[model samples]
Target: MKITVTEDQAPLDYDQDQVAQQYQEAKQQLWRSRIEEPSLMRLIGDLRGKRVIDAACGEGYFTRRLRQAGAAEVVGFDISERMIELARSQEAHDPLGIAYRVEDARTVVPQQSFDLVVSAWLLVHAQTREELQEFCDGIASRLRPGGRFVTLTTNPDVYFFRPRPDYRKYGFEMTLAEHVKGGAPIRFTMHLEKADLEIVNYYLPLTEYQEAFRRAGFRDFQLHPLHLAPDPAGRDDRADWEDFLKNPIMILFDCVKAE
Candidate 1:
């Protein structure tokens, strides 16, 4: 699945047709609804009257959701053409005025600066610091000065991902080893049994992300680790909710581009 890269470019793994298809279907399932979407929506606040770029937006799931949630304008971009195609098809069936395009978040060519840019599960693929900064810079490039940016990312701490009964039942496992120090690269594998998919992500210290944000002229950064959203009173049968609090899978970032 490796593709030729320029001397300065980072390796990308999202362009595969099968991965794109699997991920598109995966997002529609219950895990996305209960686990990540609520936390993500809360972190981004009200999108009403704001133009938003759904960076690395897969299959336009959140893109359409943003529109339904009151965004004035929504545009979604992903590196995979297959993803964009699926998104476009969904948009065609039920047009939400969302525009889908193919573009890498690390090198996006935005049509116009956005009031807000939100990325979900996107930055973990950065294998190097420069790639991480490029992601931040690209986000900065797409935003108006003083624009807001929100992200859901892999928690860098790997101490919680050891083999466990819970992981197997959930159909995914994040395998980790000796932690690499000094912002060095640590490759982590997330194997999804349900999707029959395996995803590789980079694990770097949180300081590395802060530096990237600072270097990209982002300020007032706030990090919120993911927590389980409470269910309605009717659904009192909350199984496996405690694990989300104990070993939160993702961290949410709320940041602003410098004016």
Candidate 2:
């Protein structure tokens, strides 16, 4: 299936070097370093000898980690040219043997099937139902039968039901208009040390997400909550992380292609 975007449906750009750099830095922030990465890696457990694709792989951060986790082959794809360039530069510097390409997740043409397809913060970019379905279809096309797809995305429940300004403590803020529905635009701002980065994502109800997955031939879908990385000091609870835990901004979706 071919997925094309109309003029008004164009994707948000991270083609600027500064934006790409800020995005890479944002990954090192507490929420991502502690909650997102560890939980996502755990969900995608044991990739030894598997072929993996990191769709919408901004700067190839997780792509490198996927390779290190024993995937025989790993490829990173992103729509942003600057992001891909940064990822390729990192590969050149570290010699990870990973390949990086510029491609949109909603309309990607995979060269070969993969054992796993992983994305971080990709699905939220879909501005319409058709685009959301295209994203799912593109992912399904990249995977072999029974291959798994795992992604981290905005938790709609929290975004809609528990919207709050307290997220500033975690170095970011989310703003949404009242009575938001599917396809409503969401404003996400990251307060970095030196600068603030803002990006837009669209809201789609959970039901819509499930429908799209089914239409894309995925089954056994599951939603996994984010887990805070274990404290090195062996402390069970971290007071600072309590609010974020109660109202997590992100969650994981795990599903498999139907045979």
Best by lDDT: 2
The residue pairs found clashing in candidate 2 are none
lDDT of 1 by residue, 1-259 (tens): 3222232445435567767776665565445677789889988888879999999898888888899999999999988888898899999999889989989888845635799999888887787788898998888899998999999887876544554225544445555545554433333223333445555566767888998999988999898866456665557545666665566667888889998
What overall lDDT, based on C-alpha atoms, would model 1 receive against the true structure? 0.75
Task: lDDT for model 2, please.
Answer: 0.84
lDDT of 2 by residue, 1-259 (tens): 1122233555546886777888888788877778888999999999988999999999999999999999999999998999999999999999988999989887746645799999999998886789899999999989998999999988777555543647888888777756677777676778877887776778888888889999999999999877889776788767889888888777798999999
What's the TM-score of every candidate structure? 0.85, 0.92
lDDT of each: 0.75, 0.84
Candidate 1, which segments miss by more than 4 Å at Cα? 1-13, 108-111, 160-165, 179-195, 230-233
Clashes of 2: 0
